[model samples]
Target chain A: MSAARHDGPGTGGDAPTPAPHTDDQPAVPGTGEWRRLSPRTLLVHCGWLGAPLGSLALTALATGGRITAGAWITLAAIAAAFAVVTAAGLVRWARTDFRVTAESLDVRSGLLTRRLRSVPLHRIRTVDLTASPLHRLLGVTVLRAGTAGSGEGSGELSLEALPVVEGERLRGELLARAAAEAVAEDPVLARINWRWLRYAPLTFWVVGGVFVAGGSAYRALHEMGIEPWKLGFVRRAFEEFGNGMLWLTLPAALLAVIALGSVGALVLYVENWWSYRLEWADAGTLRVHRGLLTTRSVTIERARLRGVVLREPLLLRAGGGATVRAVAGGLGNKEENRKRSGLLPPAPRREAVRVAGGTLRTPFPDPEVTGRQIDGDRHLVRHPRAALRRRRTRGLLFAVLPVSALLAGLGAAFTPVLLHAAWIYAVLATPAVLWLARDAYRNLGHQIVGEHLVVRAGTFSRDTLVLRREAVAAWTFTTSPFTRRAGLVTLTAAVAAGEEGYRVPDLAQGAAAGFAATAAPGILDEFLTRPVGHGDRTPST
Target chain B: MSEHAAPLLRPPRHRVDPRARAWWRVQALLTLSGPMLLTALVMAALSVLFFPGALPWLGPLLLVVLVLPAVAYLVVMPRMRYAVHAWELGERAVYAAGGWFWQKRRIAPLSRVQTVDTVRGPIQRRYGLATVTVTTASTAGDIKIAGLSDADAEALSRRIGEVAQDVPGDAA
Candidate 1:
C-alpha cells in the first residue's frame, strides 16, 4: 500500500553494491552484482509445497483410524519428499538473481547449469506486474517484461517475488528510456462503472458456468464413492417436481439453472474486474489495472497497437452494449491474450466506441449507421447473392439434412413415430435456417474508411474490426472450386495483432483482388491490373 | 457488377526448380507408402495368423483400399501438385501459390520477414531438394515454398534475408 520507491544502487553509480551474505553461502561469482529475491518468497514457495502433502495426510486420516506401520512409513516418506522439495526451492531461490544495467536487463538462474538472459531496454514493449492474494499480504509482486520479435516464452523476463515498491521502481526504470518524453501525468480514459454489472450476466459465461458447476459437483460426489442420483433430497425433489407436470418441469429446471448461473457470473465479474481503470500512462502507453484478490497491471505501448475490435454479442447488442478489445503485439503469450487484449468491459454502444477511438487516437466509425444523414449502405460493399445461396445450401447439407436423415433412419429401424416427427422438424427448421442465412448475409460487409479498412461480419455475435491500413503486412487470396464457380474469392489481410488475419469471405473475385491491391498496394500490385475502362481511384462500393 | 465478370488474373509466373517434380514424387511415396504399407502388413499378418478363412478376401481388399490410394498419391497427386505449386519473389514481397485441391495464394511483405529457414528431410536430401520457409512476426506469416533444389533454396533464403535486413522501420 506504500508508494515508496526503491531505486537500485546501480542506477545512481557504476559501483556494484556488495551482495548480501546468507548463513553459509559465499558471494555470487559475477562482474555485475547479483540481487536475490525477497526472503518472503520462501514462505510463498513453502505454501505451494504444503498443498499436496496436506492432501495426502488428510487422505490417510480418512482411510484409517490409527497409525499403522505402513502409514508411519508413508508419513516419513512424505516428510522426506517435503524436505527435498523445500531444499530444492531454497537453492533455486538463492540461485536466481537479476541485474538492471543501462542497456539491458540481465537475469541469471539455475541450480547446476546457470542460464543467463539479457533483454535490451529498447525492445521491451510491455512491463506487467501481478500480485496474488498471498503475495499482496506479503507486499510482494511478480514482474514480467516482454520484448518484441522474441518467440513466446523466450521473449519474457520474469522476476518473481520482489517487494511491491521495488517492482514498481524497476518497471518505471525499464520503461523510462522508452517513454523519455512522458511526464507522470494521469489521463483517465475509462473506469469501472458499477452500472456495467448488468452486462455481466448477458455473456455466455452464465450458461457455461452452470454446466461446469453441475459437472464438477457430480464428479466430486462420484469421487467420494457416492452416486449423485442416490441422494435422498435430490431424488425426492426431482420426483415431486416431475410428478405434477411433465412439460413444465423442463422450463422450470432451465430457469433455476439460469438464475444460479447469473449469480455465479456476477460474482466472477466482480472478482476479476474490481476497481478496473484504463489510463494513459507516461510515454504513449495504455495501462489497465484491475482485480479484486489477485491484482494485475498491464502496460502496452501505443506504437505496437494495430487496431481495435468492437464486439456485440446477440443479447448484449439487444441491450445496446458492446465490448472493446485491442489488437497489439508483444503484450503476452496466447494464454494471456484475452486478458491483455480486453480494453473495455461491456458498456453502452456509444461509450465503447468512444473509448475505442480514444485508445486508437482515431475516430472509430459506429457500424450502426441507421439515420438518414449517413448512407451506411453506400460505404459498405456486401457479398453477392451467391454467398447467401451457398450458406443456405451449406446449412441444409451440413446441419439440417444430417439430423433429419439420422432421425428418419432411427425411425425406420425402430418406430414410425420418429419418422413422422422428422417431417415436422424439418419443415419447422427450414424457415429458421433461411432466416439465419439471410441474417449472416446482412452481417457481411467490408469498406475502406480513410486510413483504415473496416470489416464487419459474424452471425450471432457481430464484430466490426477497424484495422489501420498501414499495419497490414500481407494479403492472401483464396479460391476453392465451388467459390470459383460462383466467381467469388476470400481476401484476408494479415496483421501482427489480434486474430492475425481478418477475412472477408465470398467477395466477387475481381473486386476482391482490386480491394486487396488498393488496401495494401505494393504486395498485390504485381498480380492485379486495372480493367479497360475503370478509373484507378474508383471505390468498389 | 461489370467488374464481377472480369477474367481471372494469370497466376504468378515463376515456378520451383524443374527437378522439384521428381523430388515431390519421391516425397509422396515415402510419406504415404510407409503408413499404408504398415497397415496392410499388420492386417495381412493378423488375418493369416488368427483368421485364416478371411485371408483369401481380406488380402486383396486391403491391397485395393490401401495400396491403390498410395499409388495414386505417389504417382498422380504429385504431378497435379507440381503443376499447382509455384512461388515468386517480388521486389516488395514474396508470393507462394500451392495446393492441388484447395488452392492458396499467400503474399508476405519482404520487410516483415523475421527469419528464413531452409529445411531438408532425409528423402528430400536424397533428391537434392529442400523446403524454404519465411517467417514473420504474425502467427500466420509462415510461408513455405517446398520442393526447391537445395542450392536454389539456400540462395533464395540468403536473398530474402538480405532484403529483410535492408528494409528499415519494420517495428518487429
Candidate 2:
C-alpha cells in the first residue's frame, strides 16, 4: 500500500515543527500556566458534594437525637470529619500546581506530603486529555500521559482545566511529535496499527444494549406493579408467572419488555457514538478523543507503548473481528469521566471506522492461518477452505437457535404465552447472527511483511493489526490441561504500552508447533533450548 | 545452573500485580484503600457487635480483613518483573522479587514503563517501608514493589528514572 506519512521530513506532512512551548519565560516553582482547576469547577463533578451531606442531615433529623448526645455525637463526629475532608478538598484546588512547559510535564499537589513529578516532553508516549460533563461545564480537562514502567507504570499527568478545542489541539500536537520521535528511533518497527478500533464499538454496542435492556426491564417491572419494589410483590409476580396465569400475562409483559429494551438500546447506541475519534499521530504516538456531552483527548508517545495485544472473543471470531488497545495513557481523563458517569461510553461505529481506518493505512494479507495464535488483535486465522472436513454446528448461532428451539418447544408446550417477546427476540437474533457470520467470512486477511507482520481480519468493520518484528515487546506461552489434550496452546504477544491487550487464542497443535518454529525463527529456537517450563493442559479457550 | 536458565533468570514477580481481575481488584483497592479502610472497619465493628467481648477478638480479624490483605497484595503478583542476563537490556527496567504463598513471577521491561513513583504511607513509613510504583501504557494495571526501605525505594526510583531515559518502549 502506498502511504503518505504526515511527519516524515520533506514529505510535506508537517515534518519539521518547533517545540510546543519555548522557554520565553522562566517557569520556576510557583510561576507557570499549569494551575489547578478552581474548586467551583471541581464541585461541579463532585458527586458527594450535595447528596452525601444532605443524607447526613436527614439521619440527624430522623433519629430525633441531639448533636451532643453519644450516638448523635459519633454521627456528628463522622459528619464533621467528612466536612473537614470536603473543606480540605475545596482548599486542595489552591495548592495544586500542574505545569506545562517546553521541557516537562509536572504535577505538584498532595495533602500531607507534596508530590512533585516531572516528565520530560521527549519521553512522553501519549498525552490524553478528557472532559466529563461537569468538567466541560467548568471548562476544565485532564491531561494523562504514558511513561514506561516495571509492572504498573510511572505515568505523567497535568490536570489543568482548558477549553475543548485547545485540549484537542494540544493532544494532536503531542501525538504527532511522539509518533515522529518513535519513527526516528526505529522506523523499521514504527508501525501504527489501529485496526482493533473497528471492532471495539460493536462489542461496546452489544454489551451496552444488554445492560440497557436488563436495567429497563428492572425499571418497567418495578413501575408496572407486576413486580413492585416490595419483595412480597416480586415474589408474588414470580409465583404467578411460574403458574397458569403466566401465559396471558407474559405476552403483555414481554411486549412492554421489548419496547423498553429497544428504547434503552437506542439510547446506549447513540450515546456511544458521539464525539469518538482516535488518531495515530505517528509511529509511537497516538491520540484518543471522544464524547458528545463531554469531549476528551489524550496523546501517547511510542516509547510508552508497553506491548501490543490482539483479542478475539467467540462472537468476534464468528464475525472474524478483534479489538486492540494501546493500554492506558491514563485514559485521557477517564477517571474524571467515570466520576461523572461519562466513562468509555460507545462511540459511533462510523466515527470509529473513520478514525481507525485513517490511522491504519493497510490490512492483513491472508484470511486464515492456523498456528500459534497471538492474543488481543493479532489473528490466528481459521479459514473454511482449509478444512478437509467442514461442519456447521449450532455454535455460530447458538444463542438465537437455542432460543428459537425453546420457543418452538416451550412456546408450543405452554400455550405460547412465554414465546411472545422471546420468540421475536430469537427471530431478530438469528438474522443478526447470520449478518455477523457473513461479516466474519468476508473480513479475513493476513500477511507477513518484511518481518513486520500486518494481519487484517473482519469483512465489514474490519480490524487490521500491524506487528513490527522488532517491536514485539513480550511474548508469553500459556497451555492448559484441556489445551494439552487437544494439542493446542495459546501464545500471547504484548505490544504498545498502556492498553490492556494481548493477541491470544487456541491453535491447532501442529499449527502451534509450526508457528513456534517459524515466527521469529531465532526466538523459538532459543525457547526450545531454554529450560522453559513444559506445560501440558487443555485450556478452556 | 542449566544454560537454559540464562535468559529465564528474571526478577521475582512484582508484589503489586495480576493483570487480570486480581490486578483490577487490587488496583481498585489500592487506589481507594486509604479512604475505604474506614468502611471496612465499620463493617468489622458491626460484625463484632454480636458479643460484648468480641471487640478484642475482632481486632486481628479486622487487621486481616483490612490491613493484611493489602499487605499480602503488596507482597505478591505483578504484570511483569525484570532481571538481566547482561547489560544489553540496560537499566530501563529493574528486577523485583516477591510472593511465597502462591508463587508468581513477572518481567517489567523498562520500555513499557510509563512512570516510576516512590510511594510512602503512614503504615508503610511506620514499618520502614516504601513502595516503588511503575506505570505502563501496555497494561492497564500498574505494577509496584512495596515494603522496600526508604533508601532502597529512592534508589530504585532513581534507577528506574535513569534507565527509562535510555530505553522507553516504542513511544520513546
Candidate 3:
C-alpha cells in the first residue's frame, strides 16, 4: 500500500495531470496485487452494537443505576452477540480482497465457497463515495462502483470501510480514462444558492413532513411502551388547546404547524445540500458533492448520462422554481437512483433550465431571445382535444365522485350534516379538479428538437424531459379501449436510463407512429409508410 | 381496419396459434376459481347468519352476481386478446401487439436486445404453447409474444439470440 502511494512521479501543479495513480494502472496491466480493506473495517462492521449499548446506558442512567435481572441477561446476550459478529467480521475481512487491473476490477471473497467477481473497467459507469458519521469518525469511507449493465441487485460492487484517501484515489483511478484533459480548476456547473431555500417550503414536505414526523415519533414512543396521548402533559396541552376560541385556535394551530414544517424543511435543505456543487470534474465525468453530516460525492461518467429532467412540482412551479435530475445510467437501483440523481436543488426556473442545458451540452434558446418564453413554451405540438376531455373525465370520475359519493353514503346512513358537507365539498372541488385537468392538458406536448426528443407532461410535477435521440432503445405505443375510440395513443420512448420510459401521452394515432418513426429513424421504418414526396407531412395510413 | 389517410400502426404479420384462446380461457378459469369459491362460501355464511329466510332467493341471486362477471371474463377476454395479439420478428426489430383493454404495440431493435427467453406455464405446456420474451436493455421495453407453438417459440428465441449476438454494443 505504501508502494502504491509513490508509484506515480509527481507532475507539474499547473498542468492538467492524469490521475495521481494512473501510472500504476498500466504498469501491471493484467496482474495486480490483491489488497485487504482497512483494518478499521472491523470497527465499522461492529458499529451496529453501539445502538443497543447506548440505549442500555440511557436506561441505566434514567433508572437511577438500577439494573433488573432481565437487563443483565439482555446485556450478556448483547455481549455474546457482539463477540460473534466481531469474530465473523474478522474472518470475512481476512477472506475478502480486491484488486484493480488495467482492464478490470476483481474481488475475491467467501471463506468456504471462494468466489471471484470481476467487473470490467469500461463498463464501470459511476463511482459513489459515501461516509456515514461512524465511517467519518473512523476515518473511512464506503465506495460503491456501479457498472453500466447492472440493473437492480447485482450491478454494483461495493468496498466497505476503506481509508478516505484510498477510496478517493480508487474512484479517480477507476474513471481515469479521460483524466488527461482535467484542468487544475474544474468548471463549476452549479452551486448552492441561498435564495433557493425559499423554494424548500413549497415542497409537499411543508405539510406532509409534519404528519410524517408526528407519526414516526408516536410510533417510536409506542414501541417503547409509552402511550403519548395518555401522558398527563399531553392531555393537558390538548385540553388547553381545545378550550381556546374555535376559529382562532384552529388558525393558530395551522400557523404553528406551518412554522414548524418550514423550519424543518429549511434545516433539511441546509443539511442535505450544505456544500452542494455540480461540476465537470474531468473531460468525461460529472461530479456532485454535497451533504453536511454524512457526506456523499458521486461521479458519473459523461457517456452514461442519457439526458436531464427539469422537474417542477405544482407548488414549485407556482413559485417560479424547478429542480434538475440527471437521467444517467448506473446511479444504482431505483432507491439509490432517487437519492443520487439530483443535479440541482429547487432554484429559479431560469437557473434550472440553464443547468439542464449545460448538462445536456445543448444551450436552450435564451428566454430573452425567444420572446421571453421558456424552453417548454416553444415548438411543442399539443395533444388533440380528446386528451383534454379524457383528463377532465378522469378527474371527475376518480377524484370527485369517490370522495363525494362516500361522504353522501355515510351521511345517508348516519347524519344529515355530512350530506350537506358532501355537496359543499363537491361544489368546491369540481372547479379545482377541472382547472388542474385543463392545466395538465395544456402542458401535454412533445417535440423532436435537434438531437433530442423533448416531452413535457404531468400536472402535479411537470417534468420536461430532454432525451438524447440516440439514447432511445425501444418504442411502446399503447392505447386503451377509450383511447382507441378517441383515436389516441400513448407513445413511450424506452431508454435504459432514468425512468426507463418517457411517455408522450394521448397523441393522435397517426401522429404517434409518425413521431416514433421520425424520432428514431430506423426502428419504426418497417411499420411506417409515408406518401410519396410528402416527407414533411405527418404520416398517412 | 379503416380507409383513412392517417398512418396508424397496422397489426403485425402474424396471429398467435388458435388453441391459445382455449389455453387463455383455462388459465383465466384457474385464476378465478379460488376467488369465486371464497365469495360463494362468504355469501353462504352471510345468508346463514343474518338472512336465513331469504337464502332460497338470495343464494341464487348471489350465484348469478358472482358467475356473471366470471363468465363474461372467461368468454370475452380470451377472444378479445386473441383478436388483439399479433407479433413479428423483422430483420432489425421485434414487434409485438397485445392486451385486451389496454392494447400495446412494442418494438425493440435487435441490436438493443439483451436476452431472449422461451417460457412455458403448465397449462401452456399442456396446450403445447410457449411464450417467447425478447428483453431489451430498457426495463419498459421487453416484448413478449405469447401463445406460439413450442417449436416456433424455440426458433424465435434462437433467432433473436443469434442476431443479437452478431449486433454489438452495450445495449444502453
Model 3 CA deviation exceeding 4 Å by range? A1-31, A182-186, A365-377, A530-541, B1-6, B41-52, B60-64, B166-170
Give the per-residue lDDT digits (tens) of candidate 2, residues A367-447. Answer: 344443333234445533322111112323466677777767887788677678567877677666666665554444333
TM-score of 1: 0.85
TM-score of each: 0.85, 0.51, 0.91
The local lDDT score (0 to 100) that residue A490 gets in candidate 1 is 84
Q: Supply the DockQ value of model 3.
A: 0.45
Q: State the lDDT of candidate 1 residue by residue for A515-541, as single tens digits.
A: 776666676666554566443322211
Q: Point out the higher-scoring one by TM-score: 2 or 3.
A: 3
Q: In model 1, what lDDT does residue A540 have?
A: 14
Between the candidate structures 1 and 3, which one is better when assessed by lDDT?
Answer: 3
* All candidates: TM-score of chain A: 0.85, 0.58, 0.90
Error of 2 at A76 (Å): 7.7
In CAPRI terms, model 2 is classed as: incorrect
**Candidate 3 pairs with clashing backbones:** A540-B7, A541-B5, A541-B6, A541-B7
The best candidate by DockQ is 3
- Model 1 / residue A82 / CA error / Å: 3.0
